[model samples]
Target: MDYANKTGGSAQKKKSFAGNKAALIFFLLTVPTLLLYIVFFLLPLGMGAYYSMTDWDGFSLSYRFVGFKNYIDILQDNRFLHSVRFTFLYATIVVVLKLFIALVLAIFLSGKLKLRGFFRSVYFFPAVLSMITVGLIFNQIFYSVFPSIGQALGIDWLSRNILGNKSTAIYGIALTNIWHGIATPMVIFIAGLASVPKDLKEASLIDGATPLQRFFSVTIPFLIPMLTVNLVMAIKGTLTVFDYIVAMTDGGPAFATESMGFLIYKHGMAEMKFGYGTAEAIYVFVMIAIISFIQIKILNRKEAGQL
Candidate 1:
């Protein structure tokens, strides 16, 4: 009894010491990150919120509190409203097309194939290019390459340059975004696919399950968590797209391609409507938060049900 008690006491003491060490290590790792978040993100966010309520141009020493005037003005601003609509349409198209292509590619590449690594690298290569570079390159393709190809093929519509037409300009931008953004979700889905249990796959095959059945029954359930993550990220990232729009359309051809980010840049930087732009920026944040929250909540519910 004495030996057992002594051993139990020593074990408890060691466990307590180990717990203390883990807590200390966690604090050390996280404190710097917390400090950085406060200094960089929280501070700027607070300042921007404060400025949004004022009549301060970005470069002014003296300004008065506007008392929700900026927010009210933005609601009446037609250009801002149009940009909001355009952004929603653009984000939806881009996310849907990108995710579809990524899923297809992930499924294909995860299969046994020749030069699989090479194919993956080829598909993923465009993602490494800067958004500005992608936009500029595609701009050239639309303006010069397509026109040349159209002329060669005697196609008048293709010769006319899609970006110049307000009707097709957003689609052109969406295509560009899809081309560049597919790799991210593809990689994510590949990782999820790798995590699927091989034994389950084998059992499905042994039971004479068709490929589609196995994919739907076995693979999809395992991919739910990753799908949730990718969905939220894709929505947030696509909504706030900046450099691609700047280089490709510059919200041009009568503001047809103007996104929320482009509108904020135009107002805050170009027109120097700082307070109003800050108000719009806050709206953008709120929109992202609401949409992301709803998507995550829905997806998590689905995932829980699947499990």
Candidate 2:
């Protein structure tokens, strides 16, 4: 009996030692990432939060703490408010267009079509291009190619520079963004569609289900996760749009296309209203966090329901 207890205790000790070693390995593997996150992300975020309460210009050696004045001023700023509104409108347009177009393209491309490989490569080619490069190319296209074609077609609207018009500039920018953004989401949708069970689709078809009915019933359930991922990406990308605006419009045509991201850059870096810009940046961070959280929650619930 004593021998058995001793043996059992020895086995337990060995098991405990193995578990400790695994935990140590995990800690060692994760520590570097944790340290980097703290240093790069958390540290900067904490400093930005602290600076938002102050009146520090970018080059200042010293500054005074104003305590939420920047936040209050931003809240009342009409230009900032307009930028926020414009960003929302742009996001809505871009997100809808991207998801719809990507879904259609994905569905078509996933089928057995001749030259499918070539078409997929062509569709995905835009995603590999630099956003700035794409923006510049589109800028020239809008300025030169579009107007020439428009004039040839006798279309007055197309003949004019769309980016130069206050009302139409947002659409031009949205078009550029959509052109670049659709590739990634389309690939994602294709992957999701690929994962859909062949048997289920065949069964649905055998049941005399129409293409639209099969899509709504079987295909859509499988694509829900992809939809959620694309939605989140689209929202975040569009909400913080800056590069395209800089390349295409520079928030031009009477600041009609000014986005929150560009506004923050202009104020914080260019204008040297460091404290104010930091406040605006913090506000944007909070807004994004809340929206993302709510979106994830809603989508997760829907995903669970589908399951």
Candidate 3:
């Protein structure tokens, strides 16, 4: 009995030592990543929050603490308010068009068709191009090519540059964004479609379900997770849009295209209202967090129900 107990104890010590070694290795591997995240992300975020409450001009070394005055002033700023409204409107238009068009293209491309691979490559190619380059290309198309075509066709409205008019400028930018943005979402939807259970599709067919019925009932349920991802990405990207505006409009036509991102850059960098701009940036962060949280909860609930 004593020898048996000794042997058992030796084996147990070996297992415990092996477990500890594995844990030590994991800790060592994670430490560098944790340090990097803290230094780069968390540290800057903390500094920004602190600076937002001060009255620091961008170039000034000395500044006074102003409490929430910057926040209060932002609420009363008409231009900022207008930009907020325009941004939300822009986001709505872009998100809807992107998802709808991408889904249609994805469904079409996923089917058995001649030259399917070629079409898929053509659709996804746009996603790999630089966004600013695409914007510049489309700017020329809207300004020159479109007007020429419209003149030839004798269409009065299109004969004019769409970006020159305040009413239609947002739509012009949205058209460019949709053309460039649909590629990623289309790829995601294609992947989701591929993952749908073949057996479920066959069952639906055997039960006399029409194509539309099968799509709505079988395919859509499998696509809910992908839809949520695309929605979140679309909303976040559009809300903080900057590059396209810079390339295409430069917030022109009397600041009609000024987005929150552009406003932040204008104040923080150009006008040197560092504190106020930081405050505005904080507000944007909060707004994004709240909206994204609500979206995730609703979508997760819907996904669960579908399951």
Candidate 4:
């Protein structure tokens, strides 16, 4: 009895020490990560807020602080307004198209497709490539190969110069972004589709329902959450579309394809209006926040069956 009691007590003490050691290690490990997050994300956010209230020209040490004037400029400026409008248009179109494509591809891929792994890799390949590289590749294809093909077919595809034409420039960027990003949603949708219980599907088939009915009534209802998540991601991606736009048209064709992100870059980096540009950034930040908030509320209500 004494030996057993001693062993039991010793084991308990050992476990206690081990648990304490593990907890301490975890706390230590998370501290640097927490600090890095605050430094990189929160610090810049706070600094941007400060700069938004000033007219710091980024060069002079004594630039005058102008309160709310930069925001006023953003509101009244025609180019800025145009950029914002164009960005929304681009974002909406790309998000819808990308989601549709992703859903379709995911359905097809989830089934017994041959060489599934190979095909998935192929579809996702463009996403891994650098935006600069993708931009260059698309530029050549749009400007050169497309025109050449047009000549062969006598279709005059080169006349509009898709990248240079105002009407089509944004769409061209959207197309490239879609190609580069479609894989991400495809992967997501595939996971969502997989999570769906097969028993539900089998039960639907036994009730003399058509395949289409099963998908519309049973499958789609469960997929709503996945759709919401994907929509948010696509919205975020569109709002921050920069490198691809910069590489393709440089927000050219008379500022036709200029997105808010590119506009921020132009002001801050190109024009050297650091604080004013930070003000624009804050506006963009607010826009993203508001949209995301609205989306979350709507989706949450839907999830609760209150929508």
Candidate 5:
């Protein structure tokens, strides 16, 4: 009887020990990452929320709570509203132009052509350069080379720097963004093209479809996933574009190139209006979240419909 009882007790202990072992392994795997995320992302976000409710100029140690006054004031600020409008315009133009160019380049490079590898490398080379460096180089070209060329050719508009005009400064910045941003989507589309089934294209050709028809029907359908990814990334990156604009225009010609990001940096870091800046930052965060969510849903819905 004692041996029987001891055997049952030993079996129960083994099962309990096994459960503990599994729990420890799970905790070991997840706890470190969980703690890091809380420390780095969540904690700072909470503190930012707290700061946004106070009237804290960054230089002052003591601050008073001001409720939603900053938020109310920001809504009435014309400059901030203008920056919002400019940001949307710039992001839309850049995303559309960049994706279109990248898609074209990808299709071209995927075909049978001479020195294809070299051309692919050349196209992708700009992406590796720092945005600031790209912006500076373009700035010099716009300011000096283009003007001289235009003067020699007697072209009226190009005779002067476009960045000097408020009407054209944002367009110039958009052009710079497109120049540097195309390579990433190009690479992604190339991968998508390569993964497309050769048999399908052969079947389309057998069905007497033209090259254009095959491209639209076969290639584009296959590329939808990649397009979705690129769309979200492009929107997010273009909206937060600050460094390039700063390096190129410094939001010049009466703050014509100013994006929400630039405004946030100017108010928070440069002007020391920490509370107002934080409120603005929060507004930007919410805007980005809504935009991203909508894009993802639409793209995902399209993908589902296609399938």
Candidate 6:
């Protein structure tokens, strides 16, 4: 009947209107975040690109366009190359150690342990603290008190300034970084572990699987997705880490502890070679992107058992 058609058409129109209204609300809600992202992230990237083509010092009024001269100089710079090498080494060591420690802690805390909440909070509390503060505190631990304690135990551990020594300075920085960054991954892994199927664990145990076997077979397989997320984060963290390095080492005892990030700061802001710094920044971005892509691909293939 025409009356039925009219009602149906009215209902369809209402649904369409609702959909449009929802879309409008969604757009409005996201507009603030989009604007903030553009202002903070995109705008800086654009300016960095422009600056990389010039010889602009930080306080300069004008700068001459140097094309890719700055980039070429960086490629040929021995110090820069050395810094890049050390950055890779630093990143690799920290990622491996931090994840291994975090995984162990997460697995332990995921079980029916006493004071689980307290332990989780204790572990995660460091992540919430300022990196500068953590660096300073850990410096004391490494320098004065730790050495004193070691001497008491006849360890002779602090024969030299760990933070100021050329040989161990990079490792020292990585240790501080691992301490600060481990909590984030631990919390993530805990969430992942908590979500693992209880039935799956029970079934595996029923089949006479030992604790280690059940973990390796059931728990770890389920953790692949979470591991992907953590690995991505750790790699990015490795490349972009700066504040703790600044507060603790300042690329100390020469350039032994110099990371790409600190070197960028030294050039762009501290040393006032803005153009060169921006070029370095872009290079770092490219490196991080490539590294992250390779890691994600490898992780995905491993999860798919294609490795």
lDDT of each: 0.88, 0.93, 0.92, 0.87, 0.91, 0.85
Name the lDDT value of residue 27 in candidate 1: 74
TM-score of each: 0.87, 0.90, 0.90, 0.87, 0.91, 0.85
TM-score of candidate 1 on Cα atoms, chains taken together:
0.87
- Per-residue lDDT tens digits of candidate 1, residues 26-137? 6799998999999999999998899899988788888899889999988998999999999889888988888888999999999999899999999999889999999999
| Residue ranges of candidate 5 with Cα displaced over 4 Å | 1-15
Off by over 4 Å in 6: 1-36, 150-157, 295-307
What shift in Å separates residue 210 of candidate 3 from its native position after superposition?
Answer: 2.1
Comparing 1 and 3 by lDDT, which wins?
Answer: 3
Give the poorly placed runs of model 2, Cα more than 4 Å off. 1-26
Q: On residues 1-307, what C-alpha lDDT tens digit does candidate 3 reach at each position?
A: 3333445556786665655665688689999999999999999999899889999988987999999999999999998998899899999999999999999999999999999999999999989998899999999999999999999999999899999898889999999999999999999999999999999999999999999999999999888899998999999999999999998888888989999999998889998899999999999999999999999998889778977
Candidate 1's error at 51, in angstroms?
Answer: 1.4
For the record, the alpha-carbon RMSD of candidate 5 to the native fold, in angstroms, is 4.9
Error of 1 at 178 (Å): 0.8
Error of 3 at 78 (Å): 0.9
User: What lDDT, from 0 to 1, does candidate 6 have?
Assistant: 0.85
Pairs in steric clash, model 4: none
lDDT of 2 by residue, 1-307 (tens): 3333445556786665666665688679999999999999999999999999999998989999999999999999998999999999999999999999999999999999999999999999999998899999999999999999999999999999999999999999999999999999999999999999999999999999999999999999899999999999999999999999999999888989999999998888889899999999999999999999999998989888978
For every candidate in turn, the CA RMSD to the true structure comes to 4.6, 4.1, 4.3, 4.8, 4.9, 4.5
TM-score of 3: 0.90
- Estimate, for each residue in 1-307, the C-alpha lDDT of model 6 and write its tens digit: 3333445556785665666666688679999999999999899999999899999998978889999999999999987898899888988999999999999999899889789999999999989899889988887777787677777778754655688688888878888889888999998999889888889988988899998888888888778878888989988878787887788788877888788999999998888899999999989989888988898888878778822
Model 3 CA lDDT for position 114: 96
Model 6, C-alpha of 69: deviation from truth (Å): 0.8
Residue 143, candidate 6: Cα error in Å is: 2.7
Taking all chains together, the TM-score of candidate 5 against the true structure is 0.91
